[model samples]
Target chain A: MEEDPVELVVPEPIPEPTPSAPPEEVEKEEQPAQPTPPAEPTTAAPPQHPFLDRKDFYIPPASRLPEGSELALAKAFLMTQSEKSNLNLYDHLTEVIVRILETRPGNVVDAFETLSADIKRSHFVVDRPNAPGAFQKASEVAPANEIGAAQVKLFEKSGLEEPGDPEAFGEIPDIMDLSNLWEWAGVSLGKEETFMLFLSLKSLVTSKPLQSVRLWGKILGAKANYLIIEGELKEGAVDEDAPQVEEEVQENAEEKKEAEEDEDVPKRKEKPVIPLPREERVGVNKYVYYVCNYAGGPWTRLPDVIPEKLQASRRIRKFFTGDLNHKIVSYPPFNDTEAQYLRCQIARISAATVVSPSGYYTFDQEDENEDEENPQPQNIIINPEFESLSPEQLIDPANWVHHVPYILPQGRVTWENPLGQKGEEEANEDEDEEEGSDAGEGEEERENVEPETGPGILSPLSSDEGP
Target chain B: MSFINLDDLPYLTLVGFTLNTEEKAAIQSSLQVKKEQEKLEEIWLWGKILGVQRDYFIAQATKDNLFSRKFYYSIDLVNWLQLPDVPSSDMDRISQVHGRFTGDPAFEYSLGEEPEEGAEEKTINEEKRLSGTVALINYETEIVPRGAYYRDTLHQLQKNVNFSGIPKGELSQLTHYLHFREGFDINKRTLQERADAFDESIDIFETIANDEPKGVWSCQTERTGSVAILRSLLWPGYVFFHTANPPKWGSMYYGTGQRNLNIGFML
Candidate 1:
């Protein structure tokens, strides 16, 4: 019974409520209960300490955060929030954040305010005259002028001119007119491609002040095709002592050596050699060529075509690989890569094929009898007295003639380079040595002199009429 | 011979075989004169074959039979001299001479004697070889869109006047193109392979899809999917173009006349 009382005392705080309890016993119980309450608090203190140590609002460290958490947060925020009536508040906030991040201004709050204000100022506003629920015409709600203004702003931001603006093209030839002209000749780049090319060409013209620009024909490559554009530079646009002149001298020397060596070979039968006509800088090299892989691709200007490269290109047939730097491995090794080859071929094709209606152009008759050593430069002018040929007369082959002189095997209009008098003297010495080796070839000597006296205009015609 | 439009030559310039205005005019007039002089049932400009010295312009003409078309070549566009017939026996000999044409009809290629002992040395001239090669190329790679021609009841192959054209969607597939040549043996095909209802009138030729050493023909859609261009890998520079709408088709061979021997390895 005594053990039971001790057990009751040990197990129960309820014993304090019993009246049978002594005053000293009650006091002892109170003391222990107070300490027990304190003990409970002591036991819970560690967990409470962790909670107390946590920040008021928590953010996971970058390492602990889930992948694409920002995107998830944004998606959740967008889903929960209703759009503002007149503005995309979410987009505005995002743009503000981006600007703040990019610029990282010292006073972020101030920067944010300024950026938001600037964006609001520039934002395209739609004039809403009708009440909230009122029916409105489509054109009234979105006027063409406002749309065009927005488009112009977008084009300006992209650093491109609006294609529809006539002034954007500046001096570039009108594509519609060019297409119509080419259609008469039975040539077309297709409707969509022509428009695309025109837009690209307009951008090209905007970059520089060109006197004239024309779409040259495409050259197909093994991998891709080249869309060529020919443009004439304004006078004084290029330097007089350009790198091309130095290249021409070196090329001529190599060509001269090759010609001399070719004469010595016994097995090969050579074609009748004609002296290249004098290099008319105003004639051939006047037009600058730019090529691009596609209609909208960036254009690259090709180097000036030296006569040596042109002559070498004539003897070989190769397919381009669309890479401008591709080396041509041929029997008579090409000196340069595909870019120069392309330029040379362009020069050759244009000279051989491009033509105009008879009497469309007239030669400067005043310079007709200029000194052979130093022929005065003459420009062919548009004939004011030109008369359109009837369809009947136009159908005849004899009625049409090539306007450009034939690019000879030596790759020039005249046999000797008038600019390089020293080179000409060396060529004479080599020719004398070649003649000495082929002793007493009087017939060959006469043939060599024939081209110097022959009329240049009639040469291309006679050659076309073959044996 | 097919009817070729001279206007289409300008489109061919996109592939690098451009004819100048003078050449175009000459060809137009010369073809008309030759058509009258030869009394050709149909005639067309074939293509240009590049040579070391000069280019040979080819013209094809058909008389009584479409299969037996005659070929004429000219160095100077004014004259169109017919190429002589090449015997089948000399074809193997001609194939041995694979060098580029010298532009001279009289140039002879001495194809060294056959491997067998006591065999005489063989030789073939440029003209005969040219004819043989043209025939070989025609046999192997010449193709027409399905239904362009139909075999008549009397077994005569005639151009189908009512043939609208192969559909634009079907143009890019090789199965829609057929080798326009004789000797398509239907009996050789398995019963399962011939399960489709084959119309004898139009399905008399072999489909180019079934050609051995597959991928021999490269088919592409151009001009905003309005025109289909097919190029032969075996003969590198042979190109054929066809348009579905308005129904126009033509082929041009502008090459060195050398077979692309690397085609096997490339494939």
Candidate 2:
């Protein structure tokens, strides 16, 4: 099945409710039944939160929500009370979660738990930090003063070292060389920290093979700040307790094959691996690994790894972690520039289209309109072709590809072609003719609604049509 | 394909016109022309005013083999001359060029002053061009892979070029247009912004080079690796320019010819 798509679109404008009839008319309706006595007015209910009041707070119809949490499925059954109300409670809940994550000042778990049942049903669960199991029951109890603290404690208690910190787990292996790697990268570490680096290498072995070990060793020796660590090699000398030399030969053969195929997936740039090794193991020292506080070297050393020197210094650890997005630092602190820069960088990397600088000769597909009086060619960029898909279908990761030839039409042919300027005159004439015809018909304002001819009076078409 | 090799420095002295309403509008419209064959209309017109005539156009300025077109009001693509040891602003240099020509009576006469109440129409004298003429100056242009000049600073050219004699009103017109289009000081913009500005200018040029209309035709010479064209946008008459790859012109043809005039292929 294709990935579910996500898209951001401007919400359609909601029309305001029309004013009710005058108070006198309402009074007349009340007194219509033969001398009925007036009852005392009751106090109105307090307003609900906007998020809870939204249509999606109610369970959606089966048609609108094909897949959702158990809570959403339960709510959909209750929504049968009204025929007009059909909503997708899960998507609405997800959007609410995302909004809370962005704007609210509370922990993600606390925020979700504090919302009304309508906003977040008890059965709905989110894949948040510290919760690894699929669809774990959501917490109903709101933790006080422990915003995001429990998640950290859960990891610590589980005997898992924090990401990028292998020494905390005490899995340092024997016969591993790390001080040499740190020295090459110009990183000064204490004796204990050097031992930690050795363990970190062993930790990396879970995700990487002996070939990865060889490549990383070369990278460390070269003083490169960043290196991609593929997950631990599954089949290795360690499984059979074979000699380390034989394992090296086997890994080299595998790596050569992988390196050749690397070109096929060019979009997967900087394949850094965050080794989530379950446990540290020692096996004839078949591979070596390196770690340090930071990739503290001149960007020149890791030119291929971190080519964009503009963002090199800030992106060191983030680069190494790869898909394991475990984080240690809070973002958008007093100085939020780094956070904003990272956002733009991510957007650039994620975009499927590439717009190269102009004036360089590339394929000139702009000549399609060369026959016109004026040829206004636009800068080349990919035009997305998501045929007939709703906004939900547009956000799929699969939809974004590097090569899709869907360029928009080029610019106008003539700047001041007197011929094209007559559009306004013709529109005005049509309006005038319509008015004249209406007058001839002598029709009453039965509908009392404005005709939807042309764009509204305030539109550019009206201005241009005017003298 | 035969090619003409001309000196590049002199035409800087000769051609002049502004991105005025009529001219800018013409070029803008031509750039946006839908027909591939007509895209070069504005460029051909500009080139024709620069005295590069082609046989394809039957312009009012061209009557016979004998040359008839004149450069009364035209825009030139020329740089301001920087003298050694003299530190002057680009504005002052541009002012000097304008100052030299605005004083000429013939230029004043060509601004609709000479043809008094339809007495008779007369051609412009080549030496006495007007002050209002625009001189597009772009220095330090890098030849991109496609042979297009990218990131050349026109605002700098506007500031440092001598425009001494041009009236304040005319000068403001040029400055206003440049500011409106490329921003007041384009150099201060980010790399992406500068790239965008340069790309826009190239879009205009690309339209002119590849597209040919009734009176406009441009083609790169196969023999000499230069682009040559004839056009009549600048004046009532046709002007032609044969620009070599490095843009040193060898010969120029100013005058008129019948419709469907075929100047031999440059290539």
Candidate 3:
């Protein structure tokens, strides 16, 4: 028996995506488990300056290139590189991004070609907020701008923008350090066909505390033209109870009660959105997550807003969708509405997970008593997924990977920082002092410094700090 | 060469526990029992009190007098307990001591129902395990929370609570802090005697139990979201406490302009 040369995932197309096709749930009772820029030409605060960005750094093209590039799709490359771990360089990063954007086309297609044309031309001449935006503003319909007029319009129409501020990025455990946020990007692999991507500055730069890192992440996502920003926020140190989303939703919904957010995001044709079943497969908490090939159908445009609507992509999507409005989603078993879209997206996430070596299986079992024999429904179908965002896979304690995206020649780049970070920068000065002490640096030190000593602390602040 | 210490503790399902220095001291102290000279007999007792019966500690005192001591805190128990495969009694005694060390005076304990006063912390800890077969100590002494306690003991208990450790008010200040512990001699009680409380629980020397605070234990509230960050620069070891401030990273899930939300107690 020979393997099929053309198939990315071998065997029959695991049809587990179709939930109604007879629920063949393969439940993995497995345990569970920044960017930005802007210059304001030096206004806001010291931390807000573009001078904080490093000038020498440049993101290298990914070592592994996606297929189909150079043929159907143009070669994807990072537009600019300025963010660095040094906090002093943030201000410079904004200017660098804007400077890179001024010359390069905003359009995703021409973006690769336009960089050299305006390499010397400076179109991004310092614009303050509302100071007649320089590039095309990604409005309901993208308005044309300086960098590759049609290209800017194209990328803007896709609705992708730099990642947003602290208010936007959430769920980062307080024990995590956002400064080295990009180190976690090693797991995500992007698609050349789909315009979807998971964009972040975590892999490209470093910073302290999770908040500022998150803020920069939002901007980079928006600028890099990411379809979905699936990163998490800082874990609660106080508010140790569930923070109420409905309160904010109700208040926000007043403006768009029941808005139609369910226009385009895709749904798992067969499975329903539900929580992941309990399975203790691995005890090692994972920081590596995957964004799959499912491009939730086109943005689910909505008529009004509800609190839950903002949570996910739904048949009746209500929250201000970063990707939906941008038209980044193109495939789906769509929910009748965006409201269904959110639930549908969640369903798709629960219905299956990315099986390593490229298998996609339903994350939760629809059938309580699944039969292993007989034409048992294939719980996981190894599909040739391109670029998909499954938060359900991410939130799993066992599977969640606090990932940061690297922007370069290829699309999504994932790299893990071997140092491992939680919060606050230790300056890593220990390297200078202890370089010679590593001779016997084996079981003894690890035994002395096992990360689990604190027993799975939910936040770095919860560690036994001195009284 | 692989650097995992596989020989130390067998990895069962999850790692069990290894007692640190403080934990060892607690076990030693709680396991200490005093001999009661009823009238004039100077009978010596050994083995920490396993429990309290009325006014007497249902203790595991040595039947013979050889182990008796005027007060031998031990240079050997530390070395002895550290030996591979320490006895189960030592482990039990240590756990009992840990319970006492971290006990909060404001915490009210009710093993089934409240005991009739003068209960000892060690006895209280043993009864927490629902097996009747658990209390090996039968009584040579009793430690009761009386209606008349001095200011000393109350100060110690108050110092070890979740809130007190949080750098705030005294837990002993609460009137409801007095609980029926291990001692109060029930047989000595005449009819119409409640015998289980102190008029001023604020007075020190009263023993308190340690358990999850009433409302925040498991099975309470919706499955609240939590993000555990491991910051080595800060404190190490297990630190479980509640904070009003939620983590900022959670907001990344919502994407752009969404407010970051947090929950209570990040353990």
| The best candidate in terms of lDDT | 1
What tens digits encode model 2's per-residue C-alpha lDDT throughout A243-338? 233344336535853664575443114432111111122211112223221222111111011112212323332212211122323222212223
Share of true Cα-Cα contacts across chains kept by each model: 0.01, 0.00, 0.00
Q: Residue A361 deviation, candidate 3, in Å?
A: 15
The local lDDT score (0 to 100) that residue A340 gets in candidate 1 is: 86
Query: Which one is best on DockQ?
Result: 1
Give the Cα error of residue A77 in candidate 2, in Å. Answer: 11
Ranking by lDDT: 1, 2, 3
Q: Each candidate's TM vs. the true structure? A: 0.46, 0.16, 0.16
Residue range B1-267, candidate 1, lDDT tens digits: 233478876445445455656678999999889999988877788877888888888889987778889999989999999989998888988888878899998888998766467765678989998888888888888888888899788988888998877665456788888888999877777777777736668887899898877777776555434567777878877878887676778787878888877555444
- Pairwise TM-score winner, candidates 1 and 2: 1
Show the colliding residue pairs in model 1: A275-A415, A276-A414, A276-A415, A277-A413, A277-A414, A277-A415, A278-A414
How do the residues A291-318 of candidate 1 rate in per-residue lDDT, one tens digit apiece? 9865566688877777667878877777
Segments in model 2 whose C-alpha atoms lie over 4 Å from true places: A1-467, B1-267
* lDDT for predicted candidate 3 compared with the true structure: 0.24
Q: What is candidate 3's DockQ?
A: 0.01
Which TM-score values does chain B get in all models? Answer: 0.93, 0.24, 0.16
Could you tell me how far off, in angstroms, the CA of residue A288 lies in candidate 2 after the best superposition? 9.2
DockQ of every predicted complex: 0.03, 0.01, 0.01
